[model samples]
Target: GYILSYNGGNIVNAKTGEKLFAQFLPDEVIPILYRYAKEKNHALLGYAGNEIITEMPDDQYVKEESRINKMNIRKVENLFEALEPHPTKLLMTGDPADMLKAENELSEILGDRMDIFRSAPFFLELVPKGIDKAKSLLRLLSKINLTPADMIAFGDGYNDLSMLKLAGMGVAMQNAAPEVRAEADYITLSNEEDGIAAALEHFCKRIFKSKRLKFRMWFKYGLKAQKLLAQGI
Candidate 1:
């Protein structure tokens, strides 16, 4: 089994805890991010390995993130130094309006080199280009000789749009964003109502019935072909 995290920026073996694939922000971009954080007075958190590193120990955003993720927040004098070498992703936290503005500015600044998007109203994430759930899932599928047609994806956020589109059947929760719901093949109950389980149960039954019908049709056509061949037609 594999776990795809950081919006597919990192893929790891579930049991062994070994990374099968990973992407990182460019080394030069770190300083630019830090400078922007300072200029905008936003708290930036660097995600490297299992740690969340930041310079603002007392920032409300940082504290809230620590509590939400249930991970220890490491404070350092210099975020750049603490995240030496590279980081998998960066999170900029501030007011929703400020983050929205930052997203547009960073998109122009980074161009095609990086992917900048919002995971929440006040959380903007910066990651390497082409790092998303669909792309990463494709890579993993190729390793096992599978394809997107074999996948059934479920999602609720904007970030999940690509993955939902790429799968054979895309399921959106009732609470999913409007855009997400529009793109999904099916919509199920909200997360609070065991949406995933409900979808699996519904789709699984239909899949089995469809497979049985296809098999019967194949058998019918196959017998006709065999009879024609036997009769020298």
Candidate 2:
């Protein structure tokens, strides 16, 4: 079974699913953690089938707003009521409002058959947590038979700093933290300002000029970052 981490939301019937994974993050803390991200207007990506589904016009919202608007309690309740009778292993994570709704509805429907377990917090931000991006990335590297010395990374946030520090070549954005900038081997423009483009252009001009690879990595990453930031919703 795939490892599941919770950001919010709830499980309806843990019995029906293989495991119910919940990360105990307070409803109040998410917004504060996302403050800089929200201000930057980043979009998150979700995979649907083979395609990536991104949020539209991403922006930060208060907990109350997330509950009242994003959660849509009545709609969630209806969905849970509809799905509880079936046996489908669905993995989910979200906000408190939705989790409570699922818990209450599923408990009424499934009763003692349900098995829900809350996972410890994997604090991606604020260093010194049980599990995080660095650990996860190291796991990924091991799976791919690679090491930190072989990696080149690009990122712009607190959570990414650790990997940036470890990677052989760490690229930081113009808008990234001062600490990140200091650690980076190179600095690119802000995501919105064709930072990736600038970096790729430099890379192409220096290293891959004769290869004639028209597509640029910097442009690609920069545009991607901008798109992510914009669609964070």
Candidate 3:
């Protein structure tokens, strides 16, 4: 009965969809990222999607921002001064080669308290400490009197891994990364083949299947029964 949104950086719920749950980057982490952006001569963008975007004409991308043309671009000489209001998400653009150096600087500031994901060649997403899709899902589940074990999650990306693993059944798309596939409870067809629906159907079929009686080999029978079963006895 709730709308789960990730755009606000964490799980958020609002009937109008314009409201954010107020989850934001850690106060300390923001300055480090902003400082890095400044030193690298990079452009920093706060994802206040509702302010700039209207409709998603397609399923994959945010195309509405293009219609509005120029966004509310701001120049911040102070670097860290811009985030005083604390936006929903943080995105930074810079030379791809400098990503490691910038990341290392952030790490030095806060260790593993923040996550900087390379979502694109030139773009990095900054998420604060103790904030992630899975953690937020857990909170939501608590409200509904459900647990992670009661959920069946599907995904194909690295960011989706945490949520997938937390679910009772983690279904990985066939096109998912190799590490993602390894962590999945089951692997389904690629998205092009309607993988989500196919996997759901398969799950239903398995769930409703009748049990078959089979021989139960006892350890007392030892090697003989094991050998017989191995020989299709």
lDDT of 3: 0.63
Higher-scoring candidate on lDDT, 1 or 3: 1
Give the winner by TM-score: 2 or 3. 3
Compute the lDDT for candidate 2. Answer: 0.45
Q: Give model 3's TM-score versus the native structure.
A: 0.63
Model 2, 116-180: lDDT tens digits are 32111111111112334455556656655889888767766554676678778788989886777
CA shift of 135, model 2, Å: 1.8
> Candidate 2 versus the native: TM-score?
0.40
Put down candidate 3 lDDT per residue, 1-233, tens digits, no spaces.
Answer: 45554422555455655433447666766766666666666666554444332111231122322232345443333435534466556766556666556666666776676667654344455776556677777877887799999998888766678888999999999988888899999999997799999999998877656322112233446678789899998
List clash counts for every candidate, in order: 0, 16, 0
List the candidate 2 regions with Cα displacement exceeding 4 Å: 1-128, 209-233
Please, what is the TM-score per model? 0.78, 0.40, 0.63
* Cα error, candidate 2, residue 197 (Å): 3.8
Which residue pairs collide in model 3, if any?
A: none
Model 1 per-residue lDDT tens digits across residues 56-150: 86788778777756778888888877775767788899988999999999899985788999866678889898899999999899987899999
